[model samples]
Target: MNPSEMSFYQPDHDAFRVSVREFVQREISPFYLEWEEQHLVDRTAFAAAGAAGVLGTRVEEAYGGGGTDDYRFRFIVAEELASAGAASYSAGLAVQEDIVIPYVMELGSEEQKRRWLPGLTSGNQLGAIAMTEPGAGSDLQGTRTTAVRDGDEWLISGQKTFITNGIQSDTIVVLARTNPDAGSRGFSLFVVEAGDSGFSRGRKLDKIGLVAQDTAELFFEKVRVGRDRLLGEEGNGLRYLMERLPLERLSIAVAALCSAEAAYGWARDYVFERQAFSQDVGDFQTVRFTLAEIETELEVTRAYVEAATLKLNRGSLTAVDAAKAKWWASELQQRVINRSLQLFGGYGYMLEYPIARAYRDARIQTIYGGTTEIMKEIIGRDIAARAKRR
Candidate 1:
């Protein structure tokens, strides 16, 4: 089924997509290459996105946001961004809307919400979540960033790597170890502002893909914040992370599916227009078969992702299910993009083409969010536990 025909999306969602498409054409397409060369998207793009009413669809209207609880609007944003060949910008926006904002809305106090949500929703400020430390990639328990209580303030000291929006974020949600003796119960979340003393961003990392999205190392050396900056309860941070991970993973899955569809469209158009052997490249039997296989894979994956998205909207999506969607869709994205690029022949290898950029960008989808290996481990553990009960 076409994505618009999916039962979960209403006419309003389709209407929202029209504006998002225009926003991408006007704001992103013109300067995306420049941003890629700079290794960062201009900060103004975020504000423009906010102005277009695409940045804060889930935020409450009271806080200058779209105020809809429905997740379909966010999905539309991802779809349009992917379709526009703006995957790096899409990933960065996903981090802001899907990851950081949800944490604040779900866990932040009323005061906290009032203080931060407006700027976030308005695009005056950008947000990032610091979870992956230099020594910790998939293992949240391995986070080495430490937060110690010092009188009325907490002193945070540690380094985080691979942080999205690290260089430009105005607010950051940092994961720190608060009570080392408490094991899994020890970690906590703290809200650190950009200008806070001793909070500095390291050089933007040179990545293989998604280069326009600023990924950098974040350092917190004796950064002090009052008790008010502590998010939720001190020891519940790990639990908070676990509870919110399903949304994050699902967001990645949505982006993956949309990107794969975009790449396939690009290839399908290219093959039909390019001539080889006195006929269109698509006229060849082998090319036709590849396109057929890709279409089948995408439709099948779409059905699964659509189901998961509905479950998420209903607040019933499990960690295992989201893990399954994330791994499958993301890995499928890499496969589809690679295959599509091959259809472009020599032109695909040239950086001037969107497919070439997509070829590079699609590589990271499988690695981040969580590795496919980690997703399988989560699924396997769940199965083992269920069998034990049975």
Candidate 2:
């Protein structure tokens, strides 16, 4: 079912979806090929998205954002982007809206908000969260990046890899170790600006899919920032990360479900239209059964994701719940896209086909945010703890 048909969405949400759909058609669909070739989307597209009122729907009106705090609007954006086969663009925007904005809004001091929120909400600037290192992917505790206090300033030095929007972001929320002896409490978050001395962007890493999204290595060689640049309290970065991860995982789940739905729609329509042995390809019982399975899986998954989105809006979504949604929906997306591509036979293997690109794009859903294995670990640990308490 389309997001409009979902009972969780109000009429206002439907209206926002219309604007988002139009934005995708006009700004993204036309230039996506050029972006894919260049390995990055033009910065103007983000500005257009900001103008269209789709970039920062949850930020406060005082900050030049939509100011609703409603998660459904963000889901609507994801749905429309998936429908338009704009996965790369969606991933980049998710980092801004889902990860960076929420971190700032929840943890930043008033001055930090005033300084960063306006440009971010207006799409005049981009933001990224630097968490993963060369050695750390899911393990936040393994982070080697360090920040040392220097009188009124802090000197941050580290390397961050696989950072979305790394190249174009005007601001980055960097996670660093502040007290080596403090364990989990040792980590802290620092706001790094683009022109800061000792800060440099490495190569835009090549990936198999989502090519238009710029992922790069970020280096900090004693990048200095005043106490004012520190986000929240010192030694609270890991706690902050854990607190905010539910929204990030939920955003990934939303994109995965929407992409699966779009792929299913494409396959269903193609199977009915394409001719085979004296009949439509969909007339075959095997194809009919495959479509049935795909539809059923999508419908069931949508219900869970819808519930999770509501929980997020109500401020009750848990890490365990988000983990379940993330792993299930992302794995489902890969399966649905793979099966849907099979429906197209030879045509599915070509890049000209959206399903082919989607197939490539879907592969990363299971790996990023948190991997399928990591999600299971989170859920499994919760289950074990609950059993012990019982």
Candidate 3:
């Protein structure tokens, strides 16, 4: 690959990716099936990731991080983790770097940053975003969780489910309605520490895929959140979410595309090894042509995604654009997984195969971070609104 085609990654980035890849291969991949069986990744895995500096690449150096603020660094981590077939690990890391750290960096007080950011960077502290309630999924405006203005504290009462890293999180950035009548304008974000009274996690959720990643229900019953805990200004949570979601969506795209790549690579290898009609399956025109088509499609998708990543780092990426990348890449991922699985025939149907696991994991990409239908709605709305203005 040419230098620009490699994006801004230097020799150091390649080296870092190599280290991460090695870690995943050695530490993560070997134990993934067991972790999935147990329904949660080992707590030590977080500590290990923190010790490796994988958890803190995006955090500033002062906070015990790598001091590399390059978004591409985080992208490399995602790509490597996905390639290793560690979707749960990838998702957990994304929560730390993509969703949680930004709140501390952008809105935290000096003391708050010092208190939390360091532990976060070290993976000693896990973080989760508590925006979706039992009543609200994609619609943040429907949030009913209330945070009442108490003297020096806000009493937060709400329930959030399907929370990634819920069981492991030492802290959560919770979205609660601070102004009852103001609608989306009234919402606010708060950082609730794990030991706080009334901050408790319910049952660990059983999911189809990503089993090693902890998903749980959280309850905030009269949770007393101090003024020091508020993330940004009152009535600004929606704006913050909208602003940061592009990065989150991009992270999802990275995972989806990388997973597709892994699945394709595995299927190609399998075809070459399996014999059919006295020849390797890959030697058959049908199998060889299928792999060729997938490679071309994957490269094209990767290029668009890389361009989107560059735009994001430059701060010029838009929501609709991110939506396009997220949906298209995720959909392409589903296609790749399906075709790869088909190439494996009955073998693909078994969970023992990597393609089987990838097939299960790829289903959620279009559903989370906004659905494909929702993405189209957003892009279409922007188009229609611009036409009307013209």
Candidate 4:
């Protein structure tokens, strides 16, 4: 499949691409490496992104957002960040745009939207979703976090681990079981404010890759919130998650595709510049063929993801389709980056190299956003159901 053959983006999207590239270069590129060392993005980075008008797409204009519902802008921003070797920053922003923002936009009430959208679009408030627990990874049904109604307020008590944007986030959308016996249907989503007395954060977690992004453990010890905080109707949380999960998986697929492109770009630039035996390393058959294979594989995968992105924007993408995009693209990213690193030999092992950081970060794409195994399960179940109907 060829990218040119697909009618994925228009001229307007291309123009927005340049704006995002400049914004990332001016604001993010300079500070990202330092953030990697400190284990957190600079607090100011979020505000800077807000001011740039690139952070909020699909958010209404009245609330300081871009107003247009185009997701191509989000895709463009991710591609630019990956090109600039800012995969960690890309991951952080994706959580806000792809994971957290949609919950408020789709499931939130008009009052909820009025209260939160401005800060969120302005980047004054960071957001994160707490779904993963210590015991459960892809299995949301096993969630033990409980939220009980106490008159006007709901008391929430549960711990969430591996939460992205944990430390710096101003608003957190938490998942807790409102009814113990209702199984998956019992869970509910709540917006917990940062200053809530009972909410406390564990230490910023240390991870092998994406060091600049904050991953933390969060505990809610009887946190209380009004009924207004609940995202949709009572007992519809799991249904909402099931409906919205395709977007999350598609977001991961977009990142994986961009990561592979960046890794290939690095390898392409390096081989021509480096010399072995007084000749360009890129001139050798082994090096040339490896790079060629990576390019071809990535181009083919790019077409599938491009189509998926269009489907998502049209509201026609299915969970099974998203799972296919997520798993294949992530696995392809890992393979491409690994090969790119191997080509660099010793230099690739160093953390300073862009490829090294990319290599480290690519490991988690398959595991998170519903593990590759879980993605296969989703698709397999769909296949079984279709066959049964026949």
Instruction: Say which candidate scores most in lDDT.
Output: 2
Better of 2 and 4 by lDDT: 2
1-390, model 4: which lDDT tens digit per residue?
222234677778777877888898899998889888888898688778889888888888877888887777888888889888887788888898887888998889999998888888878899999999999778888998999999989999999999999999999999999999887789999999999989999988999889899899999999999999999988988899889899999999999998899888888889999999999989999999998899999988988998888898898999999999999999999999999998888999998899999999899999999889999999999999999999
Worst window of 10 by summed lDDT in candidate 4: 1-10
lDDT for 376 (candidate 2)? 99
Output the TM-score of candidate 1: 0.98
lDDT of 2 by residue, 90-181 (tens): 99999999999988888989999999999998899999999999999999999999999999999999999999999999999999999999
Clashing pairs in 3: none
Please tell me which predicted candidate would have the highest TM-score against the true structure: 2
RMSD (Cα, Å) for all candidates, in order, is 1.0, 0.7, 1.7, 1.7
Estimate the TM-score of every prediction: 0.98, 0.99, 0.96, 0.97
lDDT of 1 at 36: 89
Count clashing residue pairs in model 1: 0
In each prediction, how many residue pairs overlap at the backbone (N, C-alpha, C within less than 3 A)?
0, 0, 0, 0
Residue 337, model 3: Cα distance from true site in angstroms: 0.4
Better of 2 and 4 by TM-score: 2
Rank all candidate structures by their TM-score, best first, as comma-separated numbers: 2, 1, 4, 3
**Alpha-carbon local distance difference test for all models:** 0.92, 0.94, 0.87, 0.89
Point out the higher-scoring one by lDDT: 1 or 3. 1
Error of 2 at 182 (Å): 0.4
